[model samples]
Target: MLIKGYDDGPLVAGEPLMTRPGFWSNHLMGMCDDGAGHPVPEWFGDDGADADALSEVLFDPGHWPVFRVPAAEGPGVVVVYRNQPGDYGIDYLLTPPGRSSTEQLTDWEGDLAENGLTWHELVRIADTPVHEAEGAADPAARLLLVLPLLNDLDLPAAAPARLGAALAAAGSPQDTVTHTAESLLAHLMGRSRHDADWASPLSGGY
Candidate 1:
Protein backbone atom coordinates (compact mmCIF):
# COMPACT_ATOMS: atom_id res chain seq x y z
CA MET A 1 0.00 0.00 0.00
CA LEU A 2 1.48 3.30 -1.11
CA ILE A 3 0.70 6.49 0.83
CA LYS A 4 2.06 9.77 -0.55
CA GLY A 5 1.45 13.51 0.07
CA TYR A 6 3.09 16.93 0.39
CA ASP A 7 3.75 18.86 3.58
CA ASP A 8 2.77 22.31 2.30
CA GLY A 9 -0.67 20.89 1.46
CA PRO A 10 -2.57 17.77 0.60
CA LEU A 11 -1.89 15.91 -2.61
CA VAL A 12 -3.74 17.01 -5.74
CA ALA A 13 -7.36 15.89 -5.29
CA GLY A 14 -7.99 13.54 -8.18
CA GLU A 15 -5.56 10.83 -9.26
CA PRO A 16 -3.04 11.49 -6.45
CA LEU A 17 -0.53 11.98 -9.23
CA MET A 18 2.42 14.32 -8.64
CA THR A 19 4.89 15.42 -11.28
CA ARG A 20 8.63 14.88 -10.84
CA PRO A 21 9.36 18.61 -10.75
CA GLY A 22 6.66 19.18 -8.14
CA PHE A 23 8.15 16.34 -6.13
CA TRP A 24 11.86 17.14 -6.49
CA SER A 25 11.85 20.94 -6.53
CA ASN A 26 11.24 21.58 -2.82
CA HIS A 27 13.51 18.68 -1.86
CA LEU A 28 16.47 20.15 -3.73
CA MET A 29 16.41 23.31 -1.63
CA GLY A 30 16.13 21.48 1.68
CA MET A 31 13.37 22.36 4.18
CA CYS A 32 11.73 25.75 4.06
CA ASP A 33 11.37 27.93 7.20
CA ASP A 34 8.97 30.67 6.13
CA GLY A 35 11.16 33.48 7.53
CA ALA A 36 11.98 32.42 11.07
CA GLY A 37 15.17 30.50 10.14
CA HIS A 38 14.55 27.67 12.54
CA PRO A 39 17.43 25.31 13.28
CA VAL A 40 17.40 21.87 11.81
CA PRO A 41 16.42 19.09 14.16
CA GLU A 42 19.36 17.33 15.87
CA TRP A 43 18.40 14.08 14.16
CA PHE A 44 18.80 15.60 10.71
CA GLY A 45 22.45 16.51 11.40
CA ASP A 46 24.39 19.50 9.99
CA ASP A 47 24.73 17.94 6.56
CA GLY A 48 20.96 18.03 6.01
CA ALA A 49 19.83 14.40 6.21
CA ASP A 50 16.41 15.12 4.71
CA ALA A 51 17.93 16.62 1.59
CA ASP A 52 20.43 13.77 1.40
CA ALA A 53 17.61 11.23 1.60
CA LEU A 54 15.81 13.01 -1.18
CA SER A 55 18.96 12.82 -3.26
CA GLU A 56 19.06 9.08 -2.73
CA VAL A 57 15.52 8.90 -4.04
CA LEU A 58 16.51 10.92 -7.08
CA PHE A 59 19.59 8.90 -7.97
CA ASP A 60 19.38 5.25 -6.97
CA PRO A 61 15.62 5.31 -6.42
CA GLY A 62 13.91 1.94 -6.51
CA HIS A 63 10.67 0.85 -4.80
CA TRP A 64 11.28 3.66 -2.25
CA PRO A 65 12.88 2.79 1.09
CA VAL A 66 10.60 1.71 3.92
CA PHE A 67 11.99 2.90 7.22
CA ARG A 68 11.03 1.62 10.67
CA VAL A 69 7.59 1.15 12.22
CA PRO A 70 4.11 0.18 11.11
CA ALA A 71 5.84 -2.61 9.23
CA ALA A 72 5.13 -2.92 5.52
CA GLU A 73 2.34 -4.60 3.55
CA GLY A 74 4.79 -5.74 0.92
CA PRO A 75 8.08 -4.28 -0.31
CA GLY A 76 8.44 -0.54 -0.82
CA VAL A 77 9.95 2.59 0.71
CA VAL A 78 8.88 5.76 2.57
CA VAL A 79 9.77 9.16 1.16
CA VAL A 80 9.47 12.41 3.13
CA TYR A 81 9.88 16.12 2.42
CA ARG A 82 9.50 19.60 3.95
CA ASN A 83 7.29 21.32 1.42
CA GLN A 84 6.29 24.46 3.27
CA PRO A 85 8.04 27.03 5.42
CA GLY A 86 7.57 27.28 9.21
CA ASP A 87 5.39 24.23 9.10
CA TYR A 88 6.05 21.49 11.67
CA GLY A 89 4.27 19.22 9.24
CA ILE A 90 6.26 16.66 7.23
CA ASP A 91 5.23 14.83 4.08
CA TYR A 92 5.30 11.00 4.09
CA LEU A 93 5.00 8.51 1.28
CA LEU A 94 4.57 4.73 1.38
CA THR A 95 5.47 3.49 -2.07
CA PRO A 96 3.70 0.77 -4.03
CA PRO A 97 3.93 -2.96 -4.99
CA GLY A 98 3.93 -3.87 -1.32
CA ARG A 99 0.49 -4.32 0.23
CA SER A 100 -1.89 -6.92 -1.22
CA SER A 101 -4.74 -4.44 -1.71
CA THR A 102 -5.17 -0.69 -2.31
CA GLU A 103 -7.66 -0.43 0.58
CA GLN A 104 -4.82 -0.64 3.09
CA LEU A 105 -2.76 1.89 1.24
CA THR A 106 -3.89 4.88 3.28
CA ASP A 107 -5.19 3.23 6.47
CA TRP A 108 -3.71 4.97 9.54
CA GLU A 109 -5.74 3.43 12.38
CA GLY A 110 -4.90 -0.05 11.15
CA ASP A 111 -1.22 0.72 11.69
CA LEU A 112 -1.67 1.52 15.39
CA ALA A 113 -3.06 -1.93 16.23
CA GLU A 114 0.39 -3.55 16.25
CA ASN A 115 1.27 -4.99 19.63
CA GLY A 116 3.67 -2.98 21.84
CA LEU A 117 3.68 -0.07 19.44
CA THR A 118 4.64 3.36 20.75
CA TRP A 119 5.22 6.59 18.72
CA HIS A 120 2.40 9.10 18.12
CA GLU A 121 0.33 9.17 14.93
CA LEU A 122 -1.42 12.18 13.37
CA VAL A 123 -3.30 12.31 10.09
CA ARG A 124 -3.64 15.64 8.25
CA ILE A 125 -7.00 16.11 6.63
CA ALA A 126 -7.02 18.65 3.77
CA ASP A 127 -10.47 19.54 2.60
CA THR A 128 -11.24 20.10 -1.04
CA PRO A 129 -11.48 23.72 -2.12
CA VAL A 130 -14.91 25.13 -2.89
CA HIS A 131 -14.01 25.19 -6.59
CA GLU A 132 -12.67 21.70 -7.10
CA ALA A 133 -9.82 21.39 -9.56
CA GLU A 134 -7.75 18.28 -8.85
CA GLY A 135 -9.87 15.64 -7.06
CA ALA A 136 -13.17 13.94 -7.71
CA ALA A 137 -16.77 14.52 -6.59
CA ASP A 138 -16.39 12.23 -3.58
CA PRO A 139 -15.59 14.05 -0.35
CA ALA A 140 -12.99 11.40 0.49
CA ALA A 141 -11.16 12.19 -2.71
CA ARG A 142 -10.47 15.76 -1.58
CA LEU A 143 -8.82 14.84 1.70
CA LEU A 144 -5.00 15.07 1.55
CA LEU A 145 -2.90 13.89 4.49
CA VAL A 146 0.30 12.13 5.69
CA LEU A 147 1.54 10.44 8.85
CA PRO A 148 4.16 12.88 10.10
CA LEU A 149 4.50 11.03 13.40
CA LEU A 150 6.17 8.12 11.60
CA ASN A 151 9.47 9.84 12.21
CA ASP A 152 9.36 8.28 15.67
CA LEU A 153 8.70 4.70 14.55
CA ASP A 154 11.21 2.00 15.50
CA LEU A 155 13.77 0.58 13.10
CA PRO A 156 14.66 -3.04 12.31
CA ALA A 157 18.13 -4.27 13.32
CA ALA A 158 19.27 -5.62 9.95
CA ALA A 159 17.29 -3.07 7.97
CA PRO A 160 19.38 -2.31 4.88
CA ALA A 161 22.82 -0.74 5.45
CA ARG A 162 23.06 2.28 7.75
CA LEU A 163 19.32 2.74 7.51
CA GLY A 164 18.91 2.08 11.22
CA ALA A 165 21.58 4.57 12.17
CA ALA A 166 20.14 7.08 9.76
CA LEU A 167 16.69 6.74 11.32
CA ALA A 168 18.13 6.99 14.82
CA ALA A 169 20.35 9.90 13.88
CA ALA A 170 17.23 11.48 12.45
CA GLY A 171 15.53 10.88 15.81
CA SER A 172 12.50 9.01 14.48
CA PRO A 173 12.17 6.51 17.34
CA GLN A 174 10.15 7.55 20.38
CA ASP A 175 10.42 4.48 22.61
CA THR A 176 12.79 1.52 23.13
CA VAL A 177 12.84 1.03 19.36
CA THR A 178 13.53 -2.67 18.68
CA HIS A 179 11.36 -3.89 15.80
CA THR A 180 12.92 -5.57 12.75
CA ALA A 181 12.13 -5.01 9.06
CA GLU A 182 11.14 -8.63 8.62
CA SER A 183 8.71 -8.52 11.53
CA LEU A 184 7.25 -5.19 10.51
CA LEU A 185 6.76 -6.45 6.98
CA ALA A 186 5.10 -9.60 8.26
CA HIS A 187 2.80 -7.60 10.51
CA LEU A 188 1.63 -5.37 7.70
CA MET A 189 1.10 -8.36 5.44
CA GLY A 190 -0.80 -10.20 8.15
CA ARG A 191 -3.10 -7.27 8.83
CA SER A 192 -3.86 -7.07 5.16
CA ARG A 193 -4.73 -10.77 5.04
CA HIS A 194 -7.18 -10.68 7.97
CA ASP A 195 -10.19 -8.49 8.85
CA ALA A 196 -8.16 -5.82 10.62
CA ASP A 197 -10.54 -3.05 9.65
CA TRP A 198 -11.96 -3.55 13.13
CA ALA A 199 -8.76 -1.89 14.34
CA SER A 200 -9.24 1.16 12.14
CA PRO A 201 -12.13 3.63 12.10
CA LEU A 202 -11.93 5.33 8.72
CA SER A 203 -13.68 3.56 5.86
CA GLY A 204 -10.60 4.23 3.71
CA GLY A 205 -7.12 4.40 5.24
CA TYR A 206 -6.47 7.53 3.17
Candidate 2:
Protein backbone atom coordinates (compact mmCIF):
# COMPACT_ATOMS: atom_id res chain seq x y z
CA MET A 1 0.00 0.00 0.00
CA LEU A 2 1.20 3.48 -0.78
CA ILE A 3 1.89 5.53 2.35
CA LYS A 4 0.32 8.98 2.41
CA GLY A 5 2.19 11.97 3.92
CA TYR A 6 1.70 15.73 4.52
CA ASP A 7 3.81 17.45 1.87
CA ASP A 8 2.63 17.06 -1.73
CA GLY A 9 5.75 18.49 -3.37
CA PRO A 10 8.47 16.38 -4.87
CA LEU A 11 10.64 14.70 -2.24
CA VAL A 12 14.36 15.22 -2.33
CA ALA A 13 16.46 12.19 -1.41
CA GLY A 14 18.57 12.43 1.73
CA GLU A 15 20.56 10.30 4.14
CA PRO A 16 19.58 9.16 7.62
CA LEU A 17 19.26 11.85 10.30
CA MET A 18 21.39 12.13 13.39
CA THR A 19 19.98 13.03 16.79
CA ARG A 20 20.60 16.64 17.80
CA PRO A 21 23.51 17.29 20.12
CA GLY A 22 22.91 17.32 23.92
CA PHE A 23 19.67 15.39 23.55
CA TRP A 24 20.30 11.76 24.49
CA SER A 25 23.09 12.19 26.97
CA ASN A 26 22.82 15.50 28.77
CA HIS A 27 19.24 16.48 28.08
CA LEU A 28 17.63 13.09 28.50
CA MET A 29 19.72 12.44 31.57
CA GLY A 30 18.62 15.68 33.18
CA MET A 31 14.99 14.97 32.41
CA CYS A 32 14.86 11.36 33.56
CA ASP A 33 16.68 12.08 36.79
CA ASP A 34 14.32 12.08 39.77
CA GLY A 35 14.42 10.77 43.33
CA ALA A 36 12.49 7.81 41.99
CA GLY A 37 15.49 6.97 39.83
CA HIS A 38 14.05 6.34 36.39
CA PRO A 39 16.39 4.51 34.03
CA VAL A 40 17.47 6.42 30.95
CA PRO A 41 18.03 4.91 27.54
CA GLU A 42 21.38 3.33 26.82
CA TRP A 43 22.96 5.80 24.46
CA PHE A 44 26.05 3.79 23.67
CA GLY A 45 27.67 0.45 24.32
CA ASP A 46 31.22 -0.77 25.02
CA ASP A 47 33.90 0.77 22.83
CA GLY A 48 34.49 -2.49 20.96
CA ALA A 49 32.35 -5.00 19.09
CA ASP A 50 29.44 -6.89 20.72
CA ALA A 51 27.41 -3.74 21.23
CA ASP A 52 23.74 -4.07 22.09
CA ALA A 53 21.83 -4.07 18.82
CA LEU A 54 19.24 -1.49 19.80
CA SER A 55 21.50 0.30 22.26
CA GLU A 56 21.70 3.50 20.27
CA VAL A 57 18.45 3.46 18.31
CA LEU A 58 16.68 6.33 20.02
CA PHE A 59 19.80 8.29 20.88
CA ASP A 60 21.26 7.90 17.40
CA PRO A 61 18.57 8.87 14.92
CA GLY A 62 20.44 7.24 12.06
CA HIS A 63 19.52 3.84 13.49
CA TRP A 64 16.06 4.85 14.65
CA PRO A 65 14.26 7.29 12.37
CA VAL A 66 11.37 9.13 14.00
CA PHE A 67 8.22 8.91 11.91
CA ARG A 68 4.44 8.91 11.97
CA VAL A 69 2.14 5.96 11.52
CA PRO A 70 -1.58 5.32 11.77
CA ALA A 71 -2.59 4.46 15.30
CA ALA A 72 -5.09 1.72 15.94
CA GLU A 73 -7.66 4.40 16.65
CA GLY A 74 -6.41 7.54 14.87
CA PRO A 75 -3.23 9.21 13.66
CA GLY A 76 -0.26 8.68 16.02
CA VAL A 77 3.47 9.20 15.98
CA VAL A 78 6.01 6.39 16.30
CA VAL A 79 8.86 8.48 17.60
CA VAL A 80 11.62 6.27 19.00
CA TYR A 81 11.54 2.49 18.65
CA ARG A 82 13.69 -0.60 18.97
CA ASN A 83 13.13 -3.92 17.29
CA GLN A 84 15.11 -7.05 18.05
CA PRO A 85 17.97 -8.37 15.93
CA GLY A 86 15.61 -10.56 13.90
CA ASP A 87 13.10 -7.70 13.86
CA TYR A 88 10.69 -10.05 15.52
CA GLY A 89 9.75 -7.75 18.34
CA ILE A 90 9.03 -4.03 18.11
CA ASP A 91 8.74 -1.77 21.13
CA TYR A 92 7.92 1.89 20.75
CA LEU A 93 6.63 4.96 22.53
CA LEU A 94 3.93 7.10 20.93
CA THR A 95 2.01 10.18 21.85
CA PRO A 96 -1.69 9.51 21.60
CA PRO A 97 -3.26 11.39 18.76
CA GLY A 98 -6.00 14.02 19.20
CA ARG A 99 -4.19 15.57 22.13
CA SER A 100 -3.20 19.24 22.09
CA SER A 101 0.20 18.53 23.57
CA THR A 102 2.10 15.50 24.83
CA GLU A 103 1.77 17.02 28.31
CA GLN A 104 -1.72 15.55 28.39
CA LEU A 105 -0.15 12.12 28.62
CA THR A 106 2.25 13.07 31.39
CA ASP A 107 0.80 10.35 33.59
CA TRP A 108 2.11 7.77 31.18
CA GLU A 109 0.95 4.45 32.64
CA GLY A 110 -2.57 5.45 33.61
CA ASP A 111 -2.99 7.75 30.60
CA LEU A 112 -1.87 5.44 27.78
CA ALA A 113 -3.69 2.40 29.08
CA GLU A 114 -6.83 4.46 29.53
CA ASN A 115 -6.51 5.37 25.87
CA GLY A 116 -6.10 1.63 25.05
CA LEU A 117 -2.52 2.06 23.97
CA THR A 118 0.36 -0.31 24.60
CA TRP A 119 4.09 0.15 24.17
CA HIS A 120 4.67 -3.17 22.42
CA GLU A 121 3.47 -5.37 19.55
CA LEU A 122 1.13 -2.85 17.94
CA VAL A 123 1.89 -3.40 14.25
CA ARG A 124 1.45 -6.67 12.44
CA ILE A 125 3.74 -6.46 9.41
CA ALA A 126 5.28 -9.24 7.37
CA ASP A 127 8.48 -7.52 6.27
CA THR A 128 9.85 -5.13 8.89
CA PRO A 129 12.09 -2.92 6.74
CA VAL A 130 9.67 -2.60 3.82
CA HIS A 131 7.19 -0.73 5.95
CA GLU A 132 9.37 1.15 8.44
CA ALA A 133 12.64 1.56 6.53
CA GLU A 134 10.93 2.83 3.39
CA GLY A 135 11.55 6.45 4.27
CA ALA A 136 10.76 9.27 6.68
CA ALA A 137 6.99 9.17 7.06
CA ASP A 138 6.22 12.54 8.66
CA PRO A 139 9.17 14.78 7.86
CA ALA A 140 7.05 17.89 7.40
CA ALA A 141 5.71 17.40 10.94
CA ARG A 142 2.15 17.49 9.65
CA LEU A 143 -0.41 15.20 11.26
CA LEU A 144 -1.49 13.14 8.28
CA LEU A 145 0.78 10.93 6.25
CA VAL A 146 1.83 12.96 3.19
CA LEU A 147 3.10 10.31 0.84
CA PRO A 148 0.78 8.46 -1.52
CA LEU A 149 -1.38 5.98 0.37
CA LEU A 150 -3.55 3.13 -0.77
CA ASN A 151 -4.84 2.79 2.78
CA ASP A 152 -4.22 4.48 6.12
CA LEU A 153 -2.72 1.75 8.30
CA ASP A 154 -0.57 0.07 5.69
CA LEU A 155 1.99 2.73 4.72
CA PRO A 156 4.53 2.02 2.02
CA ALA A 157 7.68 3.69 0.72
CA ALA A 158 7.43 7.33 1.84
CA ALA A 159 9.49 10.44 1.17
CA PRO A 160 12.77 10.32 3.08
CA ALA A 161 13.47 13.75 1.60
CA ARG A 162 11.12 15.36 4.10
CA LEU A 163 13.01 14.08 7.12
CA GLY A 164 14.89 17.24 8.08
CA ALA A 165 11.89 19.48 7.56
CA ALA A 166 10.47 18.90 11.04
CA LEU A 167 13.49 20.50 12.72
CA ALA A 168 12.19 23.88 11.53
CA ALA A 169 8.51 23.08 11.96
CA ALA A 170 6.57 24.17 15.02
CA GLY A 171 5.77 21.57 17.70
CA SER A 172 8.51 19.34 16.39
CA PRO A 173 10.35 16.74 18.48
CA GLN A 174 12.91 19.38 19.36
CA ASP A 175 10.12 21.41 20.87
CA THR A 176 9.01 18.40 22.87
CA VAL A 177 12.53 18.02 24.21
CA THR A 178 12.72 21.66 25.15
CA HIS A 179 9.40 21.74 26.96
CA THR A 180 9.95 18.44 28.73
CA ALA A 181 13.39 19.54 29.86
CA GLU A 182 11.96 22.67 31.36
CA SER A 183 9.20 20.86 33.22
CA LEU A 184 11.46 18.11 34.48
CA LEU A 185 14.05 20.55 35.74
CA ALA A 186 11.39 22.55 37.51
CA HIS A 187 10.02 19.43 39.16
CA LEU A 188 13.42 18.31 40.40
CA MET A 189 14.26 21.72 41.72
CA GLY A 190 11.01 21.98 43.60
CA ARG A 191 11.46 18.52 45.07
CA SER A 192 14.97 19.38 46.23
CA ARG A 193 13.70 22.45 48.07
CA HIS A 194 10.94 20.46 49.70
CA ASP A 195 13.37 17.84 50.92
CA ALA A 196 15.76 20.47 52.17
CA ASP A 197 13.01 22.14 54.20
CA TRP A 198 12.07 18.84 55.86
CA ALA A 199 15.70 18.38 56.90
CA SER A 200 16.19 21.93 58.14
CA PRO A 201 15.96 22.63 61.94
CA LEU A 202 13.82 25.71 61.15
CA SER A 203 11.11 23.38 59.88
CA GLY A 204 9.91 23.38 63.58
CA GLY A 205 9.63 19.59 63.87
CA TYR A 206 11.84 19.71 66.97
Candidate 3:
Protein backbone atom coordinates (compact mmCIF):
# COMPACT_ATOMS: atom_id res chain seq x y z
CA MET A 1 0.00 0.00 0.00
CA LEU A 2 2.95 2.31 -0.53
CA ILE A 3 1.01 4.57 -2.79
CA LYS A 4 2.64 7.38 -4.73
CA GLY A 5 0.56 10.06 -3.00
CA TYR A 6 -2.49 10.78 -0.84
CA ASP A 7 -4.67 10.01 -3.90
CA ASP A 8 -3.57 6.38 -4.01
CA GLY A 9 -6.11 5.18 -1.48
CA PRO A 10 -6.27 4.67 2.26
CA LEU A 11 -3.38 3.74 4.55
CA VAL A 12 -1.45 0.47 4.53
CA ALA A 13 -1.85 0.14 8.31
CA GLY A 14 -3.71 3.23 9.44
CA GLU A 15 -3.61 6.91 10.23
CA PRO A 16 -1.24 8.85 12.59
CA LEU A 17 1.70 6.68 11.45
CA MET A 18 5.33 7.50 12.19
CA THR A 19 6.70 8.43 15.57
CA ARG A 20 9.99 9.72 14.11
CA PRO A 21 8.71 11.31 10.94
CA GLY A 22 12.19 12.68 10.41
CA PHE A 23 13.15 9.78 8.09
CA TRP A 24 9.86 8.72 6.50
CA SER A 25 8.73 12.23 5.60
CA ASN A 26 11.68 13.75 3.81
CA HIS A 27 13.05 10.75 1.98
CA LEU A 28 12.06 9.68 -1.54
CA MET A 29 11.79 5.93 -1.05
CA GLY A 30 10.05 2.92 -2.58
CA MET A 31 10.66 -0.36 -4.37
CA CYS A 32 9.56 0.82 -7.78
CA ASP A 33 11.70 2.91 -10.13
CA ASP A 34 11.37 5.18 -7.15
CA GLY A 35 8.52 6.56 -9.25
CA ALA A 36 11.31 7.46 -11.71
CA GLY A 37 13.22 9.49 -9.15
CA HIS A 38 17.03 9.79 -9.18
CA PRO A 39 17.67 8.50 -5.66
CA VAL A 40 15.38 7.09 -2.98
CA PRO A 41 15.93 5.84 0.51
CA GLU A 42 15.30 2.32 -0.72
CA TRP A 43 18.65 2.54 -2.41
CA PHE A 44 21.27 0.47 -0.60
CA GLY A 45 25.03 0.75 -1.13
CA ASP A 46 26.41 1.11 -4.69
CA ASP A 47 24.61 -1.69 -6.54
CA GLY A 48 21.07 -1.82 -4.94
CA ALA A 49 18.79 -3.89 -2.78
CA ASP A 50 17.96 -7.53 -3.51
CA ALA A 51 14.35 -6.77 -4.38
CA ASP A 52 13.63 -10.48 -4.39
CA ALA A 53 9.97 -9.92 -3.61
CA LEU A 54 7.88 -6.82 -4.27
CA SER A 55 5.01 -7.70 -1.98
CA GLU A 56 7.39 -7.99 0.96
CA VAL A 57 9.08 -4.62 0.41
CA LEU A 58 7.96 -1.65 2.49
CA PHE A 59 8.81 2.07 2.59
CA ASP A 60 7.51 4.74 0.23
CA PRO A 61 8.79 8.29 0.40
CA GLY A 62 5.81 9.76 -1.41
CA HIS A 63 3.37 8.50 1.16
CA TRP A 64 3.67 6.45 4.37
CA PRO A 65 6.93 4.53 4.50
CA VAL A 66 5.19 1.18 4.95
CA PHE A 67 2.83 -1.24 3.23
CA ARG A 68 0.44 -3.58 4.92
CA VAL A 69 0.97 -7.35 4.95
CA PRO A 70 -2.56 -8.72 5.14
CA ALA A 71 -3.80 -11.41 7.45
CA ALA A 72 -4.93 -14.73 6.00
CA GLU A 73 -8.58 -14.39 7.03
CA GLY A 74 -11.32 -11.97 8.05
CA PRO A 75 -10.87 -8.25 8.45
CA GLY A 76 -7.45 -7.69 9.93
CA VAL A 77 -4.97 -4.89 10.61
CA VAL A 78 -1.25 -4.96 11.29
CA VAL A 79 -0.25 -2.29 13.78
CA VAL A 80 3.14 -1.29 12.46
CA TYR A 81 5.96 0.63 14.12
CA ARG A 82 5.11 3.69 12.04
CA ASN A 83 1.66 3.49 13.56
CA GLN A 84 3.07 3.72 17.08
CA PRO A 85 6.12 4.23 19.28
CA GLY A 86 8.84 2.13 20.91
CA ASP A 87 11.33 -0.39 19.49
CA TYR A 88 9.84 -3.79 20.11
CA GLY A 89 11.08 -6.83 18.24
CA ILE A 90 7.53 -6.87 16.99
CA ASP A 91 7.42 -6.33 13.26
CA TYR A 92 3.73 -5.63 13.66
CA LEU A 93 0.65 -6.58 15.72
CA LEU A 94 -2.41 -8.55 14.68
CA THR A 95 -5.08 -10.81 16.06
CA PRO A 96 -5.38 -14.54 15.45
CA PRO A 97 -7.37 -13.91 12.24
CA GLY A 98 -10.57 -15.34 13.65
CA ARG A 99 -14.10 -14.05 14.19
CA SER A 100 -13.07 -11.79 17.04
CA SER A 101 -13.82 -8.09 16.63
CA THR A 102 -10.92 -5.84 15.72
CA GLU A 103 -11.29 -4.11 19.05
CA GLN A 104 -10.58 -7.33 20.88
CA LEU A 105 -7.16 -7.47 19.25
CA THR A 106 -6.37 -3.77 19.24
CA ASP A 107 -8.24 -2.58 22.33
CA TRP A 108 -6.40 -1.00 25.22
CA GLU A 109 -3.25 -0.90 23.11
CA GLY A 110 -1.97 1.77 25.47
CA ASP A 111 -1.74 -0.87 28.15
CA LEU A 112 0.89 -2.76 26.19
CA ALA A 113 4.54 -2.62 27.14
CA GLU A 114 7.49 -1.35 25.03
CA ASN A 115 10.41 -3.29 26.43
CA GLY A 116 11.14 -5.48 23.44
CA LEU A 117 13.96 -5.86 20.92
CA THR A 118 14.17 -4.46 17.41
CA TRP A 119 15.24 -6.23 14.20
CA HIS A 120 18.76 -4.91 14.62
CA GLU A 121 18.93 -6.14 18.17
CA LEU A 122 17.63 -9.57 17.20
CA VAL A 123 20.26 -9.94 14.46
CA ARG A 124 22.98 -8.79 16.81
CA ILE A 125 21.90 -11.17 19.52
CA ALA A 126 21.64 -14.00 17.05
CA ASP A 127 25.12 -13.28 15.72
CA THR A 128 26.82 -12.36 19.00
CA PRO A 129 29.63 -14.51 20.34
CA VAL A 130 28.33 -17.50 22.26
CA HIS A 131 29.98 -16.44 25.50
CA GLU A 132 29.07 -12.76 25.15
CA ALA A 133 25.52 -13.13 23.89
CA GLU A 134 23.60 -12.44 27.08
CA GLY A 135 20.35 -12.42 25.14
CA ALA A 136 20.87 -16.16 24.71
CA ALA A 137 19.10 -16.38 28.03
CA ASP A 138 16.04 -14.87 26.38
CA PRO A 139 13.86 -17.44 24.71
CA ALA A 140 13.24 -15.28 21.67
CA ALA A 141 16.91 -14.64 21.13
CA ARG A 142 17.82 -18.24 21.76
CA LEU A 143 15.12 -19.37 19.38
CA LEU A 144 16.48 -17.10 16.70
CA LEU A 145 19.95 -18.55 17.10
CA VAL A 146 18.87 -22.17 17.01
CA LEU A 147 16.07 -22.04 14.46
CA PRO A 148 18.35 -22.05 11.41
CA LEU A 149 20.11 -25.15 12.69
CA LEU A 150 16.79 -26.95 12.68
CA ASN A 151 16.08 -26.04 9.08
CA ASP A 152 18.37 -26.09 6.04
CA LEU A 153 21.61 -25.46 7.87
CA ASP A 154 24.20 -27.69 6.25
CA LEU A 155 26.20 -29.44 8.93
CA PRO A 156 28.79 -32.19 8.75
CA ALA A 157 29.58 -35.11 11.10
CA ALA A 158 30.08 -33.23 14.36
CA ALA A 159 27.24 -30.79 13.64
CA PRO A 160 24.61 -33.29 14.75
CA ALA A 161 25.98 -33.22 18.26
CA ARG A 162 26.40 -29.47 18.10
CA LEU A 163 22.85 -29.05 16.88
CA GLY A 164 21.64 -31.39 19.60
CA ALA A 165 23.42 -29.33 22.22
CA ALA A 166 22.02 -26.10 20.79
CA LEU A 167 18.52 -27.50 20.69
CA ALA A 168 18.78 -28.68 24.29
CA ALA A 169 19.91 -25.22 25.35
CA ALA A 170 16.98 -23.68 23.49
CA GLY A 171 14.60 -25.96 25.45
CA SER A 172 13.49 -27.46 22.17
CA PRO A 173 15.61 -30.58 22.27
CA GLN A 174 14.68 -33.58 20.20
CA ASP A 175 11.84 -35.57 21.69
CA THR A 176 11.27 -39.30 21.70
CA VAL A 177 9.41 -38.54 18.53
CA THR A 178 9.49 -35.28 16.61
CA HIS A 179 8.47 -32.13 18.47
CA THR A 180 5.55 -30.29 16.88
CA ALA A 181 6.57 -26.69 16.13
CA GLU A 182 3.01 -25.55 16.66
CA SER A 183 3.02 -26.99 20.17
CA LEU A 184 6.31 -25.32 21.02
CA LEU A 185 5.22 -21.80 20.05
CA ALA A 186 1.75 -22.10 21.58
CA HIS A 187 3.01 -23.56 24.83
CA LEU A 188 5.65 -20.85 25.08
CA MET A 189 2.83 -18.31 25.29
CA GLY A 190 0.85 -20.56 27.63
CA ARG A 191 -2.67 -21.87 27.03
CA SER A 192 -6.19 -21.13 28.14
CA ARG A 193 -9.08 -23.56 27.83
CA HIS A 194 -11.27 -20.65 26.76
CA ASP A 195 -8.97 -20.10 23.80
CA ALA A 196 -9.13 -23.67 22.61
CA ASP A 197 -10.97 -22.80 19.42
CA TRP A 198 -8.34 -20.22 18.53
CA ALA A 199 -5.45 -22.58 19.18
CA SER A 200 -3.25 -24.05 16.44
CA PRO A 201 -4.24 -27.54 15.37
CA LEU A 202 -0.56 -28.42 15.15
CA SER A 203 -0.33 -27.63 18.86
CA GLY A 204 -3.64 -29.35 19.62
CA GLY A 205 -5.12 -25.99 20.60
CA TYR A 206 -6.10 -26.47 24.22
| Distance from true location, Cα of 71 in model 1, Å | 5.9
Model 1 over residues 99-133: C-alpha lDDT tens digits?
43222223222133232111112112222222322
lDDT of 2 at 34: 43
Query: What TM-score goes with each of the models?
Result: 0.24, 0.22, 0.21
Clashing pairs in 3: 18-82, 89-117
Q: Which stretches of candidate 3 lie over 4 Å from their true place?
A: 1-10, 13-46, 49-62, 65-91, 99-206
Error of 3 at 131 (Å): 45
> Against the true structure, what is every candidate's RMSD?
15.3, 19.7, 18.2
lDDT per model vs. reference: 0.28, 0.27, 0.28
Error of 1 at 177 (Å): 18
Q: Hey, what RMSD does candidate 1 come out at?
A: 15.3
Clashes of each: 12, 8, 2
As a whole number from 0 to 100, the lDDT of residue 141 in candidate 2 is 27
